[model samples]
Target: MGASQSDNAHLSKADVVSRIKTRLASADIKKAQEVGGIFLFNIIKGTTVYSWTLDLNKVEVFEGEPEDDPDTTFTLNEHYFKQLVYGKEDARTIMQAGRCSVTGDIMRAMKLEPYIKLN
Candidate 1:
């Protein structure tokens, strides 16, 4: 079984940022390093939102924008990303639905999604 709806629903912006940081601290970021350049996400958590970044190799958390523009920026809600990570939804479809948006290098960003598993 997956995490409860409440688990998804009760998430706060900081909680969402923390989750991404914790997830990056795991093996996901190692996988992400193959594709260079940084990623920035504006995570929508209910009524609030926050930005976060993953230093793929460093596996460190950077709370604010980087000095350079990110290779891509993913804007979406926590629930939608949870679905992507859990394999409940395809990344392409999500992007098509307008639930996902990207900027900068499109091909590289598209390639990066496969490595972003939730667990």
Candidate 2:
């Protein structure tokens, strides 16, 4: 579903993480298995903080503190995070607008796009 859809506006951080995990599981494993790295997502909603880690090597997801240093980290508010996951907003646009912050190896972040969405 698109991020702009009304229902998406009500999604919590956990909901978004679950959806992303589902999408990743159904993604093309061959494309991701050889691309091993860790991606960290730090999402903020009001006073709550949520963190998720994506491990490409094993196609695993951990919904808490990362076990190791992440190859790339993205920090953003919950709304923009959902927008990014659902394709309602592109990463570059949000990053350029200062709505999202990215750190670490950017190339690794680019490699994550295909695994992040079903569409």
Candidate 3:
């Protein structure tokens, strides 16, 4: 359940990664450690949910539930997350509906609010 590049009107996980990587390319995760979150990147691992971290230069990829209480956690299907990359839904609203949950450091998560381009 993903969009093709030819479509040019949709987005895929790759696209989401591209966007996030782009935004985080220069972001110093270590310096931004004050902004602590589980940073879950849910990817399809052979029909299972695979979560990982995208903090700074360290990518602590792993399986199972997150350890720390994330500032915000995005609970979305791969397809929906991709749609977010394509600007199909409003991140703020999604968060409001409990699709995305922020447990701690809400403001820090909010700081990442504007960076998400949900079109």
Candidate 4:
């Protein structure tokens, strides 16, 4: 099932980061290691910015810019980021609408869908 409205409403950037970290650490994400690389998520909420990184075995979430270069970077507003994660929004639709922007390796970004259940 998709995330509830109330559930989504209560989520903060840090909550989302924590979810990603927990999700990636699960045994379910073992297959994700195959397509892993340094991925950076740049989420903007009003004037605030939140960033997180995923590199195969580890997931690091922090405020501000990533310390190292990312193999793939995803830029989007916090709302869309939550929507995507909660299965309330379609990644392709958002990307097509220009609401989501990606840089670096397109294929690597595509590979992340399975891990995030965006597929």
Provide TM-scores for the models: 0.69, 0.89, 0.53, 0.81
lDDT of each: 0.68, 0.82, 0.52, 0.72
- The runs of at least 3 residues in candidate 1 whose Cα sits more than 4 Å from the true structure, single-residue gaps closed, are 2-6, 28-31, 45-48
lDDT of 2 by residue, 27-103 (tens): 77878888888899899888888999988978978798677888889999988887888778888889889998899
**Model 3 lDDT tens row, 14-112:** 555666666665565565555545555565524767454444225232344456644445556665555555566665666677665445455555555
What root-mean-square deviation over C-alphas does model 2 reach? Answer: 2.1
What's the residue-level lDDT of 31 in candidate 1? 59
lDDT of 4 by residue, 58-88 (tens): 4443545556688888899988888787777
Give the TM-score (vs. native) of candidate 4: 0.81
The sequence of per-residue lDDT tens digits that candidate 1 reaches over residues 1-119 is 34664475466656655766666665555556666677777777688767777555454657776666777888888878777755678888998999987777777777755445443
Model 2 segments more than 4 A misplaced:
1-4
Q: Could you arrange the candidates by TM-score from highest to lowest?
A: 2, 4, 1, 3
Overlapping backbone residue pairs in candidate 1 total 0
Clashing pairs in 1: none
> Which runs in model 4 stand beyond 4 Å of their true positions?
1-3, 28-30, 57-65, 117-119
